[model samples]
Target: MVEITLKGITKRFGNFLALDNINLKINDREFMALLGPSGSGKSTLLYTIAGIYRPTRGRIYFDDRDVTDIPPKDRNVGLVFQNWALYPHMTVFENIAFPLELRKVPRDEIERKVREVAKMLHIENLLHRYPWQLSGGQQQRVAIARALVKEPDVLLLDEPLSNLDTLLRLEVRAELKRLQKELGITAVYVTHDQAEALAMADRIAVIKEGKILQVGTPNEVYYKPKYKFVGWFLGNPPMNFVEAEVEGDYLRVYSSRIPVPSHYREIIEKLGIKEVILGFRPHDAQIVKGVGDGLLGEVYSFEPLGREQIVTISLDGVFIKVFAPEEESFTFGEKVTVEIREDRIILFDKEKEVALEYLYKD
Candidate 1:
């Protein structure tokens, strides 16, 4: 196990800044994921850590040793690529043993390590099969086994399951999590999938425009996002945003003003915010009968999901999605009020578009 530290890490591709002043610490034996949309520098950061792409500036440390200048093969880290990069002509055994062979390990030692990971991944029976003959999931396991055979201090996976089918991806996700916990090997995963990052990592680092936006446990990032982008980027349906005005501690959403929660009262007074953005997740909102304590809207669309319905309501001009229980039924263009959970409300500065939760007097 190794603790990985990156400080002032910056990467440039000629004129393009791939990573900008990135600073992060991945603890020993911790599963950390770098998550973001495409071209967001997540892969670049992962490659830099894997020693595949050297950063233009900053230092990288493994434990207490500086390894920024180390070559990819000399970094003592196992890397699995998105494409799996399996040798089509080589048997599973040969593919898994290639890394060991490159390091000039004895044949006997290579055989033992190769068989061990194969058995662990339940691919032992396919050791003699070539890459072309193996299933996608089986091939992915082979790729992972190849990386793990060397038993390096760090394991890096770049969208390792992106190529698999949905069911296969779910199966592999569990396998990957189980293997990481069973071996307690430090891992860094890179992907654009929010569910993948949330499900697999001990902590998730959300990156955007080559900068780290936030890093926290799944619950932290999900429940208490520090920025508007973090809140909007995480949820399955993502968070809904409304342009609101702070009119004497109350938020003016559309024509009606909603009362602000008491916990945020002191901070709201302190910040003296004239304009603020109200953010809430689809699950946090509920469709109520009357408009007594909620915002009014007409059911624009109702999507059924066996257990419940995802109801999209047209609020004046803005549309918001609400998760409704299966027992509830709504007709098209039906009017209803949405009760936004006060405690779960996320307030962001209208100008800066950053959460104000940290400014409150707790």
Candidate 2:
């Protein structure tokens, strides 16, 4: 097992800067995920750790050893690409054994290691099958087995499950998490899929535009995001935002005015923030049937999803979604109210677009 660290890491492709002054410490035997959208420099960060792309500036360390100048072959890291790069010409066994063969391991040891990893990945039965003859799931298992056969200290996966079907992806996702824990190996996964990172990683580093926005556990990032972008980027239906202006002790939202909660008043007064953006998750809102101390809106649309439904409400010209039980029914343009959970509401500076620390009272 190894604890990987990247300090002041910066990667530039000529004039285009890919990674900006990145500093992170990946704990030993920890599962860390690099999550971002496409062209967000997540893949570049992974390759840099694998010694495939040398950083323009900064140093990489595995535990206490600085490996800034080390070659990929000497890094002792296992890398699984998005497109499971398996050789179609070779059988699964041969593909898994290729790494050991490169080191000229005795033929007997190579066979033993290949079989061992194949069994671990539950691909032992398909060892004799070529890549062309196997299913996508089987091929991905083979790719993982090939990486694991070398007993690497750190495992790096670049969206390895992106190509698989939903069911197969879930299966592989669970298996990978289980195997990482069972083997006690340090792992770094790169993916833009928020669900995958939330379900699997011990900690997630949310990256955007070659810079890490936030690094925290799943619950921390989901519930108490440091940046407004982090909150907006993580949720399923995404968080809803509404512009508000401080009007005396009340916050004016559209034509309605609601009293400022005691928890947020101090901070708003301290910062003297007049204009702010109020964010609340769909699940954190209560859809009331009548007029009350809440944002007034009308039901615009309904999307039923088995046990629950997403109710879209139009507050004047602004629209927001609310999660309601399936039993709750509403007609088009029906008058309704949305009561945002005051404790769960995230207040952000309208200009800076960053979260305000207003829950300190609790």
Candidate 3:
């Protein structure tokens, strides 16, 4: 395994800049995900790392070795693409052995390695099947096996499970995570799916339009987002942003004013932020009954989401969503109280649209 690093990596296409001064590190044996939305420069960054596209500026390194000018074939990296990239005419055995064959491995050794990886991937039974003969999930395994058969120092995957059905995607995701851990390969996975990154990666570098916003563990990014965009991007149903005016230790959110949490009090006072944006996740707030530290609102709509339900409360003109059990039911215009987890409330600077740091923590 190798520690891959990109220093001030910038990729530009004519007048359009794909990656703007990106600096990231994937530690040895680490599973890191480049996460972002479509056209957010995530796939561009991955391809850059794979030596497929030369960066317009900056350098690439593999464990102190400068490989910025090296070709993709000499990078000692394996890449799996979204479409599987399987050859319809080639059997699974031949496909997996292609990389080894490129290096002139003997037929006996190739057969051994091919069968070994196929069994490891639980596709030994399908070794003779062509790409057209296998299901989506099986084809995905074959693609991954081809990447691993060479024992490449680093593995790069570009939305490898995006084409699979929901259940198959889940199955393949688990297998990939297990294989990476067992092999201890440094892996960089690029995807727009938050759940995939959160589930598989040890660390995630959240990207948006060519710039990285934050890099941290899944819990760190979710619970303590460094920017409002990160907070808004990482959550399901996203976060509810309420415009508020800070006064002393209280914020006048729309028509409801609530005292700021103790943890954020010092920052609020220090910044003397007159106008701020308050953000909290839907699951972090619960419905209460005229309870202390709660906001009163009327239910506007309720969405049933299989395992869980969401209650959209009309907080005056602004709507706030709260998580409820699937069995929980509510009526339109019904009065409801929402108690937010005080410590979990996030304060952001409205002008800069970024999170404000607390001067002191409790």
**Top of the candidates by lDDT:** 2
Against the unseen true structure, what C-alpha lDDT does each candidate score? 0.91, 0.92, 0.90
Per-prediction TM-score: 0.97, 0.97, 0.96
Candidate 1 vs 2: which has more TM-score? 1
Q: For candidate 3, lDDT tens digit of each residue in 207-314?
A: 998999999999998888888888888878898888888877688877677898898787777766788888999999898644345677888999898999999998
By the TM-score metric, which is better: model 2 or model 3? 2
lDDT per residue (tens digit) for residues 1-362 in model 1:
99999999999999999999999999999999999889999889999998989999999999999999999899999999999989888999999999999999998999899999999999999999999999999999999999999998999999999999999999999989999999999999998999999999999999999999999998889988988999888987889998888888678888667898676787788877778888999999889865656777888999999998899988788988989999898898877889999999988888778887664433
Candidate 1 overall lDDT versus native: 0.91
Deviation of model 2 at 9, angstroms: 0.6
**What is the C-alpha lDDT profile of model 2 across 196-262, one tens digit per residue?**
9999999999999999988999888888887788888898988898999999899999978888867
User: Global CA lDDT of candidate 3, please?
Assistant: 0.90
